[model samples]
Target: MMRFAVLGSGSGGNAAVVECGGLRLMIDAGLSAKQLSARLQSVGIDPKSLDGILLTHEHGDHVRGLKVFLKQNPIPVYTTPATARVVRETGIDGGTWKFFEAGQAFTLGGISVETFAIQHDAVDPVGFVLGDQSRRLGFLSDAGFVTRSMTERLRGLAGLFVEANYDEGLLEADTKRPWSIKQRISSRHGHLSNTQVTELIREISHPALGRVVLGHLSSDCNTPDIILNRLRACLGELGHGHVGLHCAGQHEPSDWFDF
Candidate 1:
């Protein structure tokens, strides 16, 4: 069986755990090792039992705590050449770095992970698709748009952590965030809005999808209801049913899922 859980999600920090059998992969290390350890503990995971860390990018809310994690834990860290170099230059400890080219498949802790490019502002930003025996999970939260290639690579996911960072209408009409900042969030290289994500879900909606965790939400621009409503409306059209929709908070980890 494969299981996964988000330690936390949002602009402040983001981390998630994916475990199969005795192998567990920490999807990101945005928080300090201490904070990450505590979050894992709350989810019944031992910090010392971590197998490795897989980074999506070098954003502060995604790779900020990598240095502390590597220095204190002595676990391996995996990322693309661009991400790994930036992390090291930014004072992240990557002495045990293993490079993974986007589109390449790698095996860690008895699970196979494949990386795919995501259209973000960072150099070579990517998301992961992890597979065990008969199960697969996709972890992607910071892409501006989804491509046909991305869709092809993401087929048959048991769980998904796609982004619904903001609601376009609320963000455009009500939010008081500066115009420049607003433009950035609405840009093609920025975060995905609820409508955009809803559209993507509709396009990529698959029956095998078990859980849909709407993560990396903006505290200022989005709410649970906004994301949930859009999700329900979109999936409902495709006749998708009973897929668990979860909203992860800044400090609160989500409930565990065993698939």
Candidate 2:
């Protein structure tokens, strides 16, 4: 059996826990150490019990809490060499480093993890497809665009935790961010728009896909209602309305999902 939960997700921070075969792994430590521990316990997960941390990139919203968190619960931190070097330079040098080349498969506590490069502005960003004997889950967040290879790797998963960062119409209509920032966000190396992610879901949807939790939403530009309505409709059109659709938030954790 495999289970997971998104502790919180948004522009402020992003974090999640995945457990299988009696081993627990944290996907990121973007929240403050205090909050991370509290939230973990809130979900019945003891902070110190994590087997390791899998890092996607070195962006602040994805790694700010890592330094303090590891100080309290030291464990192996896995990532690409470039990502590790960039994160270490930022003074988050507490945990033991474990390196994996992109597009390779590695094993952690009997779980097989397939890593693929992601198109994001951060250095050496990546996504993962983790699987055991009977289940697989894909984690793909903070990506600008989807690739053919990514879709191929993520197909037929039991669950997916992906980013639906912004809506094109809302982003263009918002005046808070400067034009430059907007351009960057919609660029090939920033974050995925709602349309982009929805298309990704369309391509990867299969009989075995049981759940999808949307993460890393733009606070100013995206809302749960909008994305959920869009995704729910898309899933219905694909004859996948039975698939569970969830949204993770910045201030609280999502319900645990088991597969």
Candidate 3:
């Protein structure tokens, strides 16, 4: 069985674990090492047991804890050269780092991983499709728009983790944020809106897709109800209403999703 747990998600931080057979991979380490250890323990995962860490980008919210975590664990970190250089510039060190180009496929611990570039305000952002013979898992977040290649690669997955960052109306109505910040949030290199998530879900809907986990929600601009309602409507229209739906929270690890 292949299973995953979102350790945390949001603007504050993001991380997740994907496990199959005896291999365990941490998708990102965004929180402090202490906080990350506690979250992993909450899910009965030992931090010392992690096999590797795969980074998506160089944004602080996605890679803040990476150096600290690597210092303690000394595990291999896989990412693009651009992101690795950014990490090195941050003055944190101690890990075996491996570089991979976007759109390349590689194998780690018998599982196949395919990487694809994503549009984001970061150096060389990418998403992943991981598979182990029978089941496939697609993970994409921090992307401004869903590209044609992303949709094509994500089809026919057993599970998916995609970002539903905000509701456009809510974001636009929020008076707390400055216009510049608001513009950035709604920009082509920012985050995905709820409507965009719905379109992506509809595009990737298939009978074999068992579950969809939404993450990276904006605390002020989005709510679980708003995102879920929109996604539910789209899934119903696409005849995929039976698929399970889940939301990854910022404060705690989500329940394990098994495939």
lDDT of 2: 0.92
The CA lDDT at 175 in model 3 is 95
> In terms of TM-score, which candidate is stronger, 1 or 2?
2
The positional error of residue 61 in candidate 2, measured at the CA in angstroms, is 0.5
Q: For residues 41-70, could you state the per-residue lDDT of candidate 2 as single tens digits?
A: 999999989999999999998898999999
Pairs of residues at least 3 apart in sequence or in different chains that clash in candidate 2:
none
User: What's the TM-score of each model vs. the native?
Assistant: 0.96, 0.98, 0.98
Lowest summed lDDT across 10 adjacent residues in model 2 is found at 86-95
Model 3 Cα lDDT, one tens digit per residue, 102-196: 88999997789999999989989999999889999999989988889889999989999999998999999999999999888888889999988
lDDT for predicted candidate 3 compared with the true structure = 0.91
TM-score of 1: 0.96
Alpha-carbon local distance difference test for all models: 0.84, 0.92, 0.91
The positional error of residue 181 in candidate 1, measured at the CA in angstroms, is 1.4
Worst 10 residues of 3 by lDDT: 63-72
Q: So what's the TM-score on candidate 3?
A: 0.98
Residue 249, candidate 3: C-alpha displacement in angstroms: 0.6
What value does the lDDT take at residue 50 in candidate 2? 95
Q: What is candidate 1's CA lDDT for residue 10?
A: 90
